[model samples]
Target: MKIDNEPDIADFDAALLLVMDAIWSARNVSLAARRLHRSQSTISASLNRLRELLKDQVFVWDGRQMNPTALTEQLMPQVSDIIASMRALIWRAHGGAEHAHRRFVIATSSYVTALFSAGLLTRVADEMPGVSLDFIATAPNSWTKSVLPDIDLFIVPTNVARTRGLHTARLYQDAYVCIGARDNAQLVADMAPDDFLGLRHVGFSSVPRLTASHEASHWHALGITPNYVMQTPEYLSLPAIVAATDTVAIVPGRLAQAAMRDFALKAVRPPVPVPDLEIVMVWKPAQNDDPVHAWLRGALVDLAMAFDA
Candidate 1:
């Protein structure tokens, strides 16, 4: 049976709603066209259609800007509500985030994996036990659209995850510290820049070197490079190697703190100061509206906030 007084929307479309809202917010057809990335003529056509549907002038040109008509001013609240409800429905699909049962694979650098794994695992287990997560080593250098199908996220240093077209959000900031055996004679609470540079180093080169941009700039400014004795693709292995040899490694502060108790190691400030490293969470724009994936992203972002605290 047909429901009575159901508010017929047979002729309405989301594009007209968006055009109406955009024009209202912008107060000018040309400005609204720019905001919506449409030509002014296109916006005018949509506006004409909206006028026909509502049977109102909708707006009036007041010399400087478009002013909403009395009918439009009254109807806009409902229009805006409709748009908001539509977006909420889109984002909250699939029974919302908490109830989603999905597997997500994230490609991340070793330092990020080591630093966040425990917290992320616990969060998923506690909140959404059905959710499964996997972490794999990030690709060496290819941050392209072709790799999007393989991974849900990329947790890497901002400089390394620099896919010009992908979406990126700041995860956390960290600084590099020098780690070595506690008994190493050359290790000190604070050493000279030359002393620090002169020591043999074990470098982390998983995502184009942990010294991606910020630390690299420091070395460049100092006019010297760390004398690397060895290199590894993961940060977790650095502690064991440093504990067994005279060679020291430069690592993220949080990783060094976590590794110190597991290995007989001590962390000291690097002799040369470097800017804080910006670690970011990156994902394909196509996944932006996926509720299950957004849940995982939210979990990681929350963990990052607590880690920074």
Candidate 2:
């Protein structure tokens, strides 16, 4: 059932169409490649396929840039609506993960990752099967769009989130506690400040703590130097590592409780007077209005509630 002057869309690739749109807007193979996070060769291959299928010179290159052919200009609006329709159809199919078939990026610290990733994974499996989560331990430079365009969420402390002036919601505030193997539970539990500081500590830190922040400075002000026998940039791994050995750690209460179930670990009140750490989920200004993203944020808030009272 071919119309007189219309080409069959069956021959056209849906993904290639998206490439066309990117190229049309960017008007340069290299620029479009950067925008799409693809290699120039990849984009060129799609453009070549598009030209062969459409039987039209989509874009003719001028000395400085590529200019769209007349037919290409005419097809732009119709193709754009089609792309939108395809995206909407996909979202409707899943309905739960409104941004289904899409990948979302999150930049966070190891501590926050340890706190929320498990809950988020469980929720995603049950509710948003079509959605996926990518957790990066290094915090993105949210100040610049070009620097980290793919970043969808930023898990940061309340203070840092406040400074961004971006849309953010507080997750939870977890107080610091002393954690240690149950075999040596007596060493940490009911220990005095002097004894707490003297235990062989297993330190856990991510990139954010490389240069001491206010919290570290506060610890130093009290002349509390943890006798760290081992230090690693792994937060979740700390539980298993410390649980397997005799080392103790001054860590968040939530992590300690979680580790208790899997490993023979125990949490005790830190005698050195620890501060409560408040974590927040920061929405990249650009993705703040996305319905699925907003829904995900709500789910995250719910997950945070499960961490502690």
Candidate 3:
């Protein structure tokens, strides 16, 4: 193989700039260390390395604090501009779900992540072979603002997607079911509305407080408040937790199905009827006709429709 003149990136950890920026702004080793959540010793070490690299004492203690040298002042704006330009380049070139590599990013609930993992992974393996996937979180109530303008797809509640004026198409219709440990003595085939309310529950909290929890907000409308034993932001963790405890939780039917098959958990229809959880995939108009996005969307829609069967 022919030798290449490109410099080795291993020695040039750009992360040094992060420390440099902190040190430059804070103007003190101790203060910079605190602001960057690093130890004073670490900041000092970087300062030493930076001095060696630039052949200048970037900062020197002058009676009180470490003051930036003349060279340091000159380097600041140039370094700042370089970092900003790099970030802008990365953001502008590949802002959506599809990366230069065949990787795709999907923004959804963790429950959705678990439920779709096997099927989606299988499809990618069989069809898109070398492709990779990333699942970003969809915040509880702020699904639209968070998922849109960044991701290629938004798998979220249909009405929420529509209300936000996102370009949306239905994926599947589902409903909530109460899930509990298989060994729970109180769990039975039929649970009354009061019984549902009385049962100690584990909650799926997408954000802080009850507002982010769909199950909690829906129940609140019915004048029902669960005795939440644990409120977890991660939905995948709920199955293992519920399987080991007597706490019951209202989860989407498909999510309950996936968990029941995997864990020692049981599910029963909630006494109070809930509106069908019509999940949809929302995207920008720009991706409407994009080929890669279309293929991924088609695969997802097909997988979701299979859930219905």
For model 1, residues 100-149, the per-residue Cα lDDT tens digits are 77888888876688788899899878766778888987663765557678
For candidate 3, the per-residue lDDT at 245 reads 77
Candidate 2 minimal-lDDT segment of 10 residues: 206-215
Q: How do the residues 1-309 of candidate 2 rate in per-residue lDDT, one tens digit apiece?
A: 788867687777788988888888788999989988999999999999988888898987887787899998778755654565465445546664644665678888776776678888888788678788898865433446574566788787665553344555666787877777888854655668777778878776444435243345468778778777776665667788878888887677777777788998777787776678888777654565365576577677778886555
Instruction: Provide the overall lDDT of each model, using Cα atoms, as 2-decimal numbers.
Output: 0.78, 0.72, 0.72
Winner on TM-score between 2 and 3 is 3
Pairs that collide in candidate 3 are: none
Tell me the lDDT of candidate 1. 0.78
Clashes of 3: 0
Q: Could you tell me the TM-score of candidate 1?
A: 0.68
Number of the predicted model whose lDDT against the real structure is largest: 1
The best candidate by TM-score is 1
Q: Tens digit of lDDT per residue, candidate 3, span 1-309?
A: 434754444656676776777777777889999988989999889888887777789888987888889998778655644454455345435643234346677878888887787898898776556568888886535645555566767788765554344456667888888788989877666667777777888877766665456556566787767677678887677778888878887788888888877899888887776677888777775665454566577678779888867
Q: What is the TM-score of each predicted model, taking all chains together? A: 0.68, 0.61, 0.62
Single out the weakest 10-residue window by summed lDDT for candidate 1.
205-214
After superposition, the stretches of candidate 2 with alpha carbons farther than 4 Å from their true spots are: 1-99, 140-146, 160-162, 207-215
